[model samples]
Target: MSRQKMLARALIVFALLGACGTGARLAAAGEFVAEARTIAELKAVFGQVESRTVVPARARIGGTIREIGISEGREVKEGEVIARVVDDKLTFELNAADAKIAALQSQLDNARTEFDRAQQLLARGIASQSRLDQAKTQFDVIVSQVAAAQADKAVIEQRTREGAILAPATGRVLTVPVTLGSVVLAGEEIARIASGQYYLRLSLPERHATEIKEGGTVLIGQRGLSPVASGGSAAARQARIAKVYPEIADGRVIADVEVADIGDYFVNERTLVWIPVGERKVIAIPPAAVTTRHGVDYVRVATPDGPLDVAVVLGETFQDGGGPRLEILTGLRPGDRIVMPDVAP
Candidate 1:
């Protein structure tokens, strides 16, 4: 071969080797990359909004409701009269008792006169001792009967006063089960009154009960209301866990959360409550970097050995003005290289 041909062949070989080296360098530089953040974390317990109903306070005595002092939805103080019962029989009994007392007084006056006369006759020896004793016994018996009648009258008056149903506590009237002039039976519910102090009862999964403690702080949010951003802009009421019901029902443990600042809203069984477990600071990454497969969560991290697969335990999601990020519970640390979606994996 000629020297010029040999030199051209050597040049072509060098060119091919240079191209292969460049391709390998590019391939080595290309790996998945992700931007991560360390975020302040908080745990929020979510609950549903609910309206509560007031229970009826029953009347102790049966009578016709002649007067209703308050209407439905009226706020009443303790011991305020809500309704009055019209009981003519009680009134008549009282009147008859008074008449009987007056009649007894006249008969006692006559008996006193006869007893005095009998005493005089016995002293003058014109009447026997037995006659004097008889007059005395008659007077004592009449006085006793009069006292009994008066006692019966007093009882009737007391019962008549009790026939007027009064508000047992300070609360708002939720319902009027009986109308004016309606006859209510004894111990019948006249109206339902709701106390201003409200309590939030929550049924949580039984497993969560182990983590909950009495007096723990609880955040109550109306369910259906828009989720609040992670800042202080949202309105959330706070409450304390007053008690934990010892029994479990329907696979949930019952807990009572007390909220003293009860507004003019009705609460029912559907109310939701959010209990705070605790707070911690953790490393966070974009949700896109994390992927789930076969019910296990994984993330690709850049390492000396190329893209490395990491299994991570996830914490709460933090959403702020800058958007949302996922908190990493484990298997991740600060300064770890995480894959960003735009980078080729």
Candidate 2:
């Protein structure tokens, strides 16, 4: 064939391919739509799920640890004994005090007897007044010594019982820092526990500091969770912003979201948290019609020429009765018709 003829054939093939490409886009017109809706306002953020209350079990009296009653990850009830400290030293102190009291008691008895004798003799005009006064004074001094020894014994006895560290609250023991035979000081931490309830802690940009307040709703969920089959499980996921920290650190505002069934989550586990910041009109599109490719989100929009793949910036993905929906922050407008492509968006 002549060179001109060959060029003509190549042009015809190029035109055919363009025509077919247009046909595919035109066929997508039935699958998508652009509509103005009050999509639930939300901001998706990554956060750590942690126990809202963590209590430390500490040794109240200095002693060597004698027994550890619970292991890590063990559930303990409030007031349950977590460990025992050897009370041998405390026992020795109490015994010494008791011995001192016994020895002093004998002296006190002798003094009291002499005071009685002096009193009897004085009444009969046989004892000097100085002798009676000295006897009475000696008796009183001995009595005070005995009382002081008894008080010392009482404190040692109380400390002996307190050697057994008890759980501060119902919780799962997270760690046991002291082992059996380890000597510990008074007020030293022995174990750390996660108090039963938990919350999700997250940081938002400091710019949102003024907007976060207590009682604000936050949706919390882990990755790979499908829509729950039961309505009860769905309701359990609702979280509220229980506390908004007053101070900003590193350009972020801290907030705590309280949830009821957070015990299943491990401490510091990362999960998604969606806070409802504010609401406004948005072009909401169903997730089924949206396509993601190479880190970009796209949806097929039916243009005047034909269906076109338009890149969209999705704000926050929200769920409702229908299913997951995307909040289109850019690239679409109200009254624009769209469709799901036969292959993909």
Candidate 3:
């Protein structure tokens, strides 16, 4: 088929779409009354897929990364160990602490034996009171020394436990900056996780900022750079405005649209989105009432003289609960009756 024939057929199919309820065309009467109805004026804008919260898994102690259990795009749970860091010095220090504790424990044993013997002698009137007191002091000092060594060992053990890098949030890992054998310092990031729910981040023009609010409804267009149809099945997704940032930067207002099932979307991925800036009254008619000829759109009107075809300039098509309705920009007025053509046999 020729391009013109294809175009004509496509327009015919588009014209057959009719809204329901009050906006529905009176097919039996073969006429539709044009009236002004309030509709949301949508502004087409680009939105980026983003996570609500991005948390980074960080190392608590300085060490060389010994192993990494996660990579980019891997899912992780909160407090999950994603990597392990090893500090050879910490192991050595722990060993030294243990050895010191052992030595002090031996000394404590000897001091304890001496204190007991001194106490026994004192009780038998063989040792002076001062001698027993000195032995007791030595034993107590050795015991304290052992306890200090054990405390040092505990500190080392805690540092060793910090070597494991745990994920901060339960979500997909976005980036892993450090690899195996990479030397990292304490408080350094190991991996960045995209956590919580994903949403679309819209940077709309500052002019529409006042019109947007939390809990407002918006439409999602096609993914990527594909041109969005005026309003069609593919662009029928409706989302709620989760938040609107107060600050404006570079004449743009940032807002977040909460969309479920966007978790599979890549972070920073761009998609077209339609935001309702405000409401306006427009004359909408069903597609079945309009006809196209020679690349021009025409609608028949039932005038007092007879039915006459009037050329109409059409705007964006809007999808609502009724159906898809085409907005007539011009060539028609409110209270005008349109003649609906008979269905072809």
Q: Name the better of 2 and 3 by TM-score.
A: 3
| Worst ten in a row by lDDT for model 1 | 225-234
Model 2, CA-based lDDT: 0.80
Residue 160, candidate 1: C-alpha displacement in angstroms:
1.7
Angstrom error at residue 206, model 1: 2.4
Task: Kindly provide the TM-score of model 1 when superposed on the true structure, using C-alpha atoms.
Answer: 0.64
Q: List the candidate numbers ranked by TM-score, top first.
A: 3, 2, 1
Which candidate's TM-score is highest?
3
How far off is residue 33 in model 2, in Å? 6.4
Taking the tens digit of each residue's C-alpha lDDT, what string does model 3 give over 16-57? 553222123333446788888998877778889988789988
Give all TM-scores, in the order shown: 0.64, 0.69, 0.83
lDDT of 1 by residue, 202-227 (tens): 77787776767898876665533335
Residue 126 error for model 2, in Å? 2.5
Name the runs in model 1 displaced over 4 angstroms.
1-56, 222-238, 269-272, 276-345
Error of 2 at 71 (Å): 2.0
Best by lDDT: 3
